[model samples]
Target: MGRARFAFGVLAFGYAFLYLPIAMVIVYSFNESRLVTVWSGFSFKWWQALFANEAMLQAAWLSLRIAFASATTAAVIGLAAGYALVRARRFPGRTLFGSLVVAPMVMPEVVMGISMLLLFVGSERLMGGPDRGFLTIAVAHITFSIAFVAIVVQARLTDFDRSLEEAAMDLGATPWVTFRTITLPLLLPAVGSGWLLAFTLSLDDLILTQFVAGAQSQTLPMRVYSSVRLGVDPQINVLATIVVSVAACALMLSGWLTRKKV
Candidate 1:
């Protein structure tokens, strides 16, 4: 009984430690004072200001667009790569290809960002095209996001039963038909999880976007960083609160869906 009680106490403490800062951010978001440290009174003025800021709104929209585009592209490419790795046997350079697929996940974001920027600039110079902008940012985001999607899909594929796919193929089904009918259905959960992971990564990214984004394409995090450089504003807190709330809802929904599947 004592050991059980001690374990429970430790878990409770861990949860509090994780959530306390988030609680503080949500509470201070309502502060009426310009100074975040002192609580003058509670008000919705910060939320109102956040909604009224046109530049911030535009940045938010652009961020959403980039996140969706990058996530979709990443999901498609990652699904193909994951399928190849899991299903193929005795392929050429299989080990090297697998390492390349996962390398971006472990690589430092700063190095990845700088390398992507240089590559885009070099391409533009050689091709005699317009300089980097939204397209560069989207492509950079896809590069990192694909690694996340591949990781998730690979985890699911590791436990998958290969004989089921073989059974479908032996029963007079073509390779494409077997894959579409049998493999794809079993892989749906992994695909959904991968897409969500990719989307979240794209949305929350700051470093890579900062390196690749052009003058006209500022993401929400970029705008927030610039604003915070001036000083902490209550509106920034309000924006953070909104993002936290949305993220929480998404996690809850994912949990509920998983539970339903089980």
Candidate 2:
């Protein structure tokens, strides 16, 4: 009983430690103060200001579009890579291929960002086209996010039963048909999880996006960072609150979907 009590106490402390600051941010978002730390009664003025900021709104929309595109593209590529890693046991250079698939997950983001930036610039010089903007940012996001998605899918695939596929094949189904009708259905939860993770990563990334993004393609993180550099405003609090709310909703929805699928 003592040990259980101690463990519960520790868990409570850990949660409080992690969420206390976030709680403070949410609380202060409603404060009617230009001075962020000071509370001068509750007001929706900052929320109003956040909506009124055209640059912030545009950055948010751009970030969402990039995240959606990147997550979808990463999911497709990652699913194929994961399938190959699991289903192909005797492929040529399998070790090297597996290493390459997962390398980006552990590789330093700064290094990846710089390398991608150089690649894009060099490609532009060689081909005399393809400017740095939305497409570049989406491609950059996919580069790193694909590894995360692949890792998730690969984990799920590792535990999967091969008998299901074999049974489908014995029933005169083609490999593609077997995969689409049997394997894909069983793997839907993991795929959805990977896509959500990729989406969140793309939305939260700053360093990589900074390297690839152009003046006209600034994202919400970039805008928030710039605003914070000039000192915290009430609007920044409102923006952070909105982000936290959206993230919470996404997490809840993902949880619901996972449970329903199960």
Using TM-score as the measure, the top candidate is 2
- The sequence of per-residue lDDT tens digits that candidate 1 reaches over residues 1-262 is 9999999999999999999988888899999988888999999989899999999999999889988998899989999888888778669899998889999998999999999888888888899645666788889988887877777677778887889889988898999998899887877777777887788888888999998886778998899999999998888999989999899887876566444532
Return the TM-score for each candidate structure.
0.94, 0.96
Residue 1 alpha-carbon offset, candidate 2, angstroms: 2.4
Best-performing candidate as measured by lDDT: 2
For candidate 2, the lDDT comes to 0.90
Model 2 Cα lDDT, one tens digit per residue, 71-106: 999999999889889889898899998999999988
Instruction: Output the worst ten-in-a-row residue range by lDDT, candidate 1.
Output: 253-262
- lDDT on C-alpha atoms for all candidate structures: 0.86, 0.90
Candidate 2 Cα errors over 4 Å, as ranges: none
